[model samples]
Target chain A: MKVRLIDLYVAFLKIGGLTFGGGYAMLPMLQREVIDKHGWATIEEVLDIYAICQCTPGIIAVNTATMIGYRKRGIVGAIVATLGEITPSVVIITILASVLTRVQDFAVIQRAFGGIRIAVCALIVQSVLTLSKKSITNTGTVLLFLASVALTLIAGLSPIAVVVLAIVAGLIIGKVKERRAA
Target chain B: MIYLELFWEFFKIGLFSIGGGLATLPFLYKLAETHPHWLTAAQIGDMVAISESTPGPIGINMATFAGYQAAGYPGGLIATLGEVAPSVIIIIIIARFLSNFDKNPKVENAFYALRPVVVGLITFAGLKLLQIVVYGEGVLNGRAMIAFAILVVGVLKFKKVHPLVWIGLGAVGGIFLNLGG
Candidate 1:
């Protein structure tokens, strides 16, 4: 079924604005809006799009919106959906940045933000733990995880370079397993 | 000049930052070191707190924050546009020409390995941020450490509570604990 570009924009705008904490939090809301509400894509299609988002670069939520938009209407749909998704962030953060700059020097604001910084670090730690639980499953993956951490933390390799190495390592690992099985 | 630089830098960030929103933190850390005027080590912590507390993807939120810090509202717009441009272009190319790329075994294998590595990158970024918040000018901030410990426990125990709540609690804790200084 064809979806209107305006409808696509509004749908994604709601998805972007309402969801909090980003990442997986955006998924269920996304499933509801596109599948149940708009009928833009089916469950299987959404899952496929989601998987594609995972391996690709950029933000997963934005990528998912782009792929779905492309499916619904084409390139223009992709642009519209992506714009809708980020519009909220651009507007909200811009406003926050402007206002915060004015009063940021206040002692009270400083103190509050000090606490907020702690909370932010805790949040990242939580994310690391949660991501590790899912990604570092078996021995090979565990080694890959450790090697990556050491490469960046100890060897001081750039993350982009490490990403490339990991891809090559994965391919070699996959090839060796295939050879052994054959 | 700054506008172009912001756009170019964020464009690169968009292209390379994989896995998820938090993945951008590693690149931002590098960027902070290179362009401390645009974003300081201390501000990175603020950016994280603000980005997590607000709506939308943290990556996009951060791009906006950095852009605004660099060149005001126009910079924010440009940086955000630059960040999303690569994703839009790449996704369109894949959707139009490489629709089955995700199903390719080679691609599958790469991602299988890439996932754990991305986790590592993010962990490294998290540790860096922890260092920034818990340390002040080559010395440790004991108050921030206490707040970090408490929040870590709070987050683990109340896994379902929205992060905003925890952030709010942290703000209150910071004030009472005299963390502002």
Candidate 2:
């Protein structure tokens, strides 16, 4: 059976509308929707998409939505899925902006956000651990992780510079491995 | 000149920020610090808080908020579209090429190499955020530290529990703790 663009749209809309804590937080939700719910892709395929989404230059949720959409229903699927993923945020922010101008300083709201800040920290830690287990499989990777942590936290280096350096390191490593095999 | 610059700046951000919204933070931090002078570091911190609590990608949330700051609604539209445009275009291109590209050995090697780098960046992001949350200007203090320790243990031990539950518990805990204080 051929998947329709509308199906892709609705699936992504659900993914975007409900999932919180950004891209990593959306993984389980996406797994449920795409793997168990829709059968659009296998778990392995989803993992691959996750890896690709991480490396590509864009929002991970959007990139994952686009990839899954394209996988399911081609170009039209991509467009609809992207629109679906973004629609919730756009609408919600607009509403929040209107309502928040008046009572943003209320003590209750401040307390709520203070709570959220702590939760955000937990989410970040969880994301790091999850990604580390999946991505850092070797000593080289461990060293890289340590170096990156040090650079950002201790050295006060720019993250962009670290990312660039990492990419260059990847290229060099790839060349070296290729030469060794050859 | 400002609108044009805004469009170009966001476009570049969309083009280069890999590994998702948090990945864009470094660039946005740089942008706020160096170029446009549209926002202060504290404002960026506030924007991050707003973005996290809100429904969208942090990058998009930031672009929209920053755009609104710079040129109101129209500017927000411009920034959002500009930030999203690159991914939309590149994904389309990659979609067309992905099948043939998937089997290429060099591409595979490149991706293999990239895995570690992505992890490193993500780890760095988490650490930086932790530093900010724990030790930034308004410190969380000893009470907050106890709460954070509990959260970490709860999450790591009970991996099956949903994150939203953790967030909810943290919120309730904060209310009670702050009330007591």
Q: Candidate 2 on A121-166: residue-level lDDT in tens?
A: 6766676677678778888777777776687657867666776677
For each candidate, the alpha-carbon lDDT, in order, equals: 0.88, 0.70
Candidate 1 chain A: minimum summed lDDT over ten consecutive residues — where?
A18-27
Minimal lDDT window, size 10, model 1 chain B: B172-181
- RMSD to the native, candidate 1? 1.6
**lDDT of predicted model 1:** 0.88
lDDT tens digits, residue span B1-181, model 1: 9989999999988998888778888888888878988888678888888898899998999999989998898989999999988999999999989888889999988988998999999988888877777776578888788778888998998899888887888788877887634
TM-scores vs. true structure, each candidate: 0.95, 0.76
Over 4 Å off in model 2, which ranges?
A: A1-11, A18-55, A67-77, A154-156, B1-9, B25-78, B138-140, B179-181
Return the TM-score for candidate 2, rounded to 2 decimals.
0.76
| Best model number under lDDT | 1
